[model samples]
Target: MKKKKGDKTMKNLKKKLMYSIAVSTLLLGTTIGVFASWSGQINVQPPGWGGSVVSWSGVTKTSNSSKFAISGIKESNSLDPYAQLVNSNAAAKSSWCAIRQGQTTSVNDNTGVANYIYYTRCKTNNLEPNSNIISYSFNPY
Candidate 1:
Protein backbone atom coordinates (compact mmCIF):
# COMPACT_ATOMS: atom_id res chain seq x y z
CA MET A 1 0.00 0.00 0.00
CA LYS A 2 1.29 3.53 -0.86
CA LYS A 3 1.33 6.34 1.74
CA LYS A 4 -1.08 9.27 1.21
CA LYS A 5 0.11 12.85 0.64
CA GLY A 6 -1.77 14.14 3.72
CA ASP A 7 0.05 11.64 5.96
CA LYS A 8 3.47 12.85 4.76
CA THR A 9 2.44 16.46 5.39
CA MET A 10 1.34 15.58 8.91
CA LYS A 11 4.65 13.88 9.65
CA ASN A 12 6.61 16.92 8.41
CA LEU A 13 4.55 19.25 10.63
CA LYS A 14 5.26 17.12 13.72
CA LYS A 15 9.00 17.09 13.04
CA LYS A 16 9.06 20.88 12.68
CA LEU A 17 7.22 21.36 15.98
CA MET A 18 9.64 19.09 17.84
CA TYR A 19 12.67 20.85 16.37
CA SER A 20 11.32 24.28 17.41
CA ILE A 21 10.74 23.13 21.00
CA ALA A 22 14.26 21.72 21.27
CA VAL A 23 15.88 24.88 19.95
CA SER A 24 13.92 27.08 22.36
CA THR A 25 14.93 24.93 25.33
CA LEU A 26 18.59 25.02 24.33
CA LEU A 27 18.54 28.82 23.94
CA LEU A 28 16.91 29.35 27.32
CA GLY A 29 19.42 27.08 29.08
CA THR A 30 22.34 28.90 27.48
CA THR A 31 20.97 32.30 28.51
CA ILE A 32 20.51 31.21 32.14
CA GLY A 33 24.01 29.73 32.34
CA VAL A 34 25.58 32.92 31.02
CA PHE A 35 23.80 35.10 33.58
CA ALA A 36 24.43 32.79 36.56
CA SER A 37 28.19 33.40 36.69
CA TRP A 38 28.14 37.17 36.29
CA SER A 39 30.68 39.08 38.39
CA GLY A 40 30.93 42.86 38.38
CA GLN A 41 32.46 45.72 40.34
CA ILE A 42 30.73 48.79 41.65
CA ASN A 43 32.24 52.20 42.44
CA VAL A 44 30.38 54.49 44.77
CA GLN A 45 30.71 58.26 44.66
CA PRO A 46 30.84 60.50 47.70
CA PRO A 47 27.50 61.07 49.33
CA GLY A 48 26.03 64.53 49.58
CA TRP A 49 24.21 64.32 52.89
CA GLY A 50 26.30 62.35 55.37
CA GLY A 51 29.82 62.72 56.71
CA SER A 52 32.47 60.12 57.48
CA VAL A 53 33.29 59.34 61.11
CA VAL A 54 37.03 58.97 61.15
CA SER A 55 37.76 58.52 64.83
CA TRP A 56 36.24 58.40 68.31
CA SER A 57 38.06 58.11 71.63
CA GLY A 58 37.62 58.82 75.33
CA VAL A 59 39.45 61.84 76.67
CA THR A 60 41.46 61.84 79.89
CA LYS A 61 43.72 64.19 81.84
CA THR A 62 46.80 62.35 80.74
CA SER A 63 48.31 62.94 77.30
CA ASN A 64 47.00 60.65 74.56
CA SER A 65 46.82 60.56 70.79
CA SER A 66 43.78 59.40 68.78
CA LYS A 67 44.46 58.06 65.32
CA PHE A 68 41.91 57.63 62.52
CA ALA A 69 42.36 56.18 59.07
CA ILE A 70 40.89 57.43 55.79
CA SER A 71 40.01 55.20 52.85
CA GLY A 72 38.15 55.15 49.50
CA ILE A 73 37.90 58.93 49.38
CA LYS A 74 38.47 60.59 46.04
CA GLU A 75 39.66 64.12 45.38
CA SER A 76 37.20 66.85 46.29
CA ASN A 77 37.24 70.54 47.08
CA SER A 78 35.91 70.36 50.64
CA LEU A 79 37.11 67.02 51.98
CA ASP A 80 38.70 67.53 55.36
CA PRO A 81 38.91 66.06 58.86
CA TYR A 82 37.84 67.90 61.99
CA ALA A 83 38.83 67.23 65.60
CA GLN A 84 37.07 68.50 68.68
CA LEU A 85 37.44 67.98 72.40
CA VAL A 86 34.00 67.57 73.93
CA ASN A 87 33.15 67.77 77.59
CA SER A 88 29.97 65.77 78.03
CA ASN A 89 28.98 66.98 81.51
CA ALA A 90 25.32 66.77 82.39
CA ALA A 91 25.51 68.99 85.47
CA ALA A 92 27.40 71.80 83.80
CA LYS A 93 24.81 74.15 82.33
CA SER A 94 27.45 76.27 80.65
CA SER A 95 27.93 75.24 77.00
CA TRP A 96 31.46 76.64 76.99
CA CYS A 97 33.89 74.75 79.16
CA ALA A 98 37.56 75.22 79.92
CA ILE A 99 39.73 74.68 76.83
CA ARG A 100 42.02 71.69 76.79
CA GLN A 101 45.37 71.32 75.10
CA GLY A 102 45.22 69.48 71.79
CA GLN A 103 46.81 69.25 68.34
CA THR A 104 45.46 67.99 65.03
CA THR A 105 47.13 67.17 61.71
CA SER A 106 43.91 67.45 59.76
CA VAL A 107 43.48 68.43 56.17
CA ASN A 108 41.95 71.71 57.28
CA ASP A 109 45.18 72.49 59.09
CA ASN A 110 47.20 71.77 55.97
CA THR A 111 47.72 73.86 52.85
CA GLY A 112 46.53 71.39 50.16
CA VAL A 113 44.38 68.32 49.73
CA ALA A 114 45.27 65.37 51.94
CA ASN A 115 44.12 61.78 51.97
CA TYR A 116 44.99 59.03 54.48
CA ILE A 117 45.24 58.75 58.24
CA TYR A 118 44.48 61.66 60.58
CA TYR A 119 45.50 62.14 64.22
CA THR A 120 44.46 64.29 67.15
CA ARG A 121 46.43 64.45 70.38
CA CYS A 122 44.95 66.04 73.47
CA LYS A 123 46.40 66.71 76.91
CA THR A 124 43.64 67.46 79.30
CA ASN A 125 43.99 70.33 81.78
CA ASN A 126 41.68 68.43 84.16
CA LEU A 127 39.84 71.67 85.00
CA GLU A 128 36.50 70.32 83.76
CA PRO A 129 36.60 66.80 85.10
CA ASN A 130 33.21 66.09 83.59
CA SER A 131 34.39 66.84 80.06
CA ASN A 132 35.93 63.60 78.81
CA ILE A 133 34.97 62.97 75.23
CA ILE A 134 37.01 63.56 72.10
CA SER A 135 35.20 63.47 68.78
CA TYR A 136 36.68 63.39 65.29
CA SER A 137 34.44 64.06 62.34
CA PHE A 138 35.04 64.17 58.58
CA ASN A 139 33.03 66.48 56.38
CA PRO A 140 33.09 67.53 52.79
CA TYR A 141 33.29 71.32 53.07
Candidate 2:
Protein backbone atom coordinates (compact mmCIF):
# COMPACT_ATOMS: atom_id res chain seq x y z
CA MET A 1 0.00 0.00 0.00
CA LYS A 2 1.18 3.53 -0.80
CA LYS A 3 2.48 5.43 2.25
CA LYS A 4 0.52 8.38 3.58
CA LYS A 5 1.97 11.90 3.41
CA GLY A 6 2.39 11.97 7.20
CA ASP A 7 4.32 8.69 7.14
CA LYS A 8 6.70 10.00 4.47
CA THR A 9 7.41 13.10 6.50
CA MET A 10 8.04 10.99 9.59
CA LYS A 11 10.44 8.74 7.69
CA ASN A 12 12.44 11.74 6.43
CA LEU A 13 12.65 13.15 9.96
CA LYS A 14 13.86 9.84 11.32
CA LYS A 15 16.57 9.58 8.66
CA LYS A 16 17.72 13.10 9.36
CA LEU A 17 17.87 12.38 13.08
CA MET A 18 19.95 9.27 12.50
CA TYR A 19 22.43 11.14 10.33
CA SER A 20 22.68 13.90 12.87
CA ILE A 21 23.35 11.47 15.67
CA ALA A 22 26.05 9.68 13.68
CA VAL A 23 27.81 12.90 12.77
CA SER A 24 27.69 14.11 16.34
CA THR A 25 29.09 10.87 17.69
CA LEU A 26 31.94 10.90 15.21
CA LEU A 27 32.79 14.49 16.03
CA LEU A 28 32.74 13.85 19.78
CA GLY A 29 35.00 10.85 19.44
CA THR A 30 37.46 12.79 17.32
CA THR A 31 37.61 15.64 19.78
CA ILE A 32 38.30 13.35 22.70
CA GLY A 33 40.95 11.40 20.83
CA VAL A 34 42.75 14.48 19.70
CA PHE A 35 42.77 15.91 23.19
CA ALA A 36 44.16 12.74 24.70
CA SER A 37 46.96 12.44 22.16
CA TRP A 38 47.84 16.08 22.28
CA SER A 39 47.89 16.13 26.04
CA GLY A 40 50.43 13.38 26.22
CA GLN A 41 52.58 14.95 23.55
CA ILE A 42 52.41 18.32 25.24
CA ASN A 43 53.17 17.13 28.78
CA VAL A 44 56.53 15.37 28.66
CA GLN A 45 59.16 16.46 26.12
CA PRO A 46 62.69 15.32 25.38
CA PRO A 47 65.76 17.16 24.20
CA GLY A 48 65.02 18.96 20.90
CA TRP A 49 61.44 17.82 21.20
CA GLY A 50 58.88 20.33 22.40
CA GLY A 51 56.95 19.43 25.54
CA SER A 52 55.37 20.94 28.59
CA VAL A 53 57.03 21.73 31.89
CA VAL A 54 57.84 18.67 33.97
CA SER A 55 59.53 20.29 36.98
CA TRP A 56 61.89 23.06 38.04
CA SER A 57 64.41 24.25 40.73
CA GLY A 58 66.62 27.34 40.75
CA VAL A 59 68.02 30.33 42.66
CA THR A 60 68.88 33.96 42.01
CA LYS A 61 71.04 36.68 43.54
CA THR A 62 71.93 40.26 42.71
CA SER A 63 75.52 39.91 43.87
CA ASN A 64 78.15 37.59 42.41
CA SER A 65 79.31 36.66 45.89
CA SER A 66 75.82 35.55 46.73
CA LYS A 67 74.86 31.92 46.32
CA PHE A 68 72.51 30.98 43.50
CA ALA A 69 71.31 28.11 41.39
CA ILE A 70 69.37 27.69 38.13
CA SER A 71 67.77 24.55 36.86
CA GLY A 72 65.74 23.74 33.78
CA ILE A 73 65.28 21.07 31.13
CA LYS A 74 66.16 22.18 27.64
CA GLU A 75 64.92 20.85 24.32
CA SER A 76 68.53 20.01 23.54
CA ASN A 77 71.94 20.05 25.14
CA SER A 78 74.35 22.89 24.46
CA LEU A 79 77.12 20.33 24.01
CA ASP A 80 75.24 18.37 21.38
CA PRO A 81 76.28 18.94 17.75
CA TYR A 82 76.76 22.57 18.75
CA ALA A 83 79.96 22.22 20.67
CA GLN A 84 81.76 24.40 18.17
CA LEU A 85 78.84 26.78 18.08
CA VAL A 86 79.02 27.08 21.84
CA ASN A 87 82.78 27.52 21.87
CA SER A 88 82.75 30.12 19.15
CA ASN A 89 79.99 31.97 20.89
CA ALA A 90 81.91 31.86 24.15
CA ALA A 91 85.04 33.27 22.50
CA ALA A 92 83.06 36.14 21.06
CA LYS A 93 81.55 37.10 24.40
CA SER A 94 84.19 36.15 27.05
CA SER A 95 85.63 39.64 26.78
CA TRP A 96 82.47 41.22 28.12
CA CYS A 97 82.28 39.40 31.46
CA ALA A 98 84.31 41.00 34.28
CA ILE A 99 84.18 37.97 36.51
CA ARG A 100 87.89 37.82 37.21
CA GLN A 101 89.63 40.45 39.30
CA GLY A 102 91.98 42.71 37.25
CA GLN A 103 91.01 40.63 34.22
CA THR A 104 89.87 42.93 31.44
CA THR A 105 89.58 40.27 28.75
CA SER A 106 88.70 36.61 28.78
CA VAL A 107 92.16 35.26 27.90
CA ASN A 108 92.14 32.53 30.52
CA ASP A 109 88.56 31.82 29.64
CA ASN A 110 89.04 28.10 28.96
CA THR A 111 85.51 27.42 30.05
CA GLY A 112 84.45 27.62 26.38
CA VAL A 113 81.51 29.90 26.81
CA ALA A 114 80.10 32.61 24.62
CA ASN A 115 78.59 35.75 26.17
CA TYR A 116 78.40 33.84 29.45
CA ILE A 117 79.76 30.78 31.23
CA TYR A 118 76.84 28.61 32.13
CA TYR A 119 76.91 24.95 32.88
CA THR A 120 73.96 22.71 31.92
CA ARG A 121 72.58 25.35 29.61
CA CYS A 122 73.63 28.23 27.37
CA LYS A 123 72.47 30.11 24.30
CA THR A 124 74.04 32.34 21.66
CA ASN A 125 71.27 34.91 21.84
CA ASN A 126 71.03 34.91 25.65
CA LEU A 127 67.47 33.70 25.51
CA GLU A 128 66.07 31.82 28.51
CA PRO A 129 65.25 28.22 27.72
CA ASN A 130 61.75 27.00 28.34
CA SER A 131 61.32 24.23 30.85
CA ASN A 132 59.24 23.06 33.79
CA ILE A 133 58.51 25.44 36.67
CA ILE A 134 61.35 26.02 39.18
CA SER A 135 62.29 26.96 42.74
CA TYR A 136 65.53 28.61 43.95
CA SER A 137 67.38 29.31 47.21
CA PHE A 138 70.85 30.60 48.18
CA ASN A 139 73.06 32.61 50.53
CA PRO A 140 74.48 36.00 49.56
CA TYR A 141 77.96 35.68 51.02
Predicted candidate 2 versus true structure: per-residue lDDT over 1-141, tens digit per residue: 887999989999999999999999999987764343210111122233222122112112122331222222222323211111112122331222211112211122233322222221222222324332222111111
TM-score, candidate number 2: 0.31
Question: lDDT of each model, Cα atoms only?
Answer: 0.31, 0.29
Off by over 4 Å in 1: 39-141
Please report, as a residue range, the 10-residue window in candidate 2 with the lowest summed lDDT: 79-88
**What tens-digit string does per-residue lDDT give for candidate 1 at 33-57?**
4443221211222223322221222
- Clashing residue pairs, candidate 1? 87-131
Candidate 2 residue 10 C-alpha distance from true site, Å: 0.2
Which candidate comes out best when scored by TM-score? 2
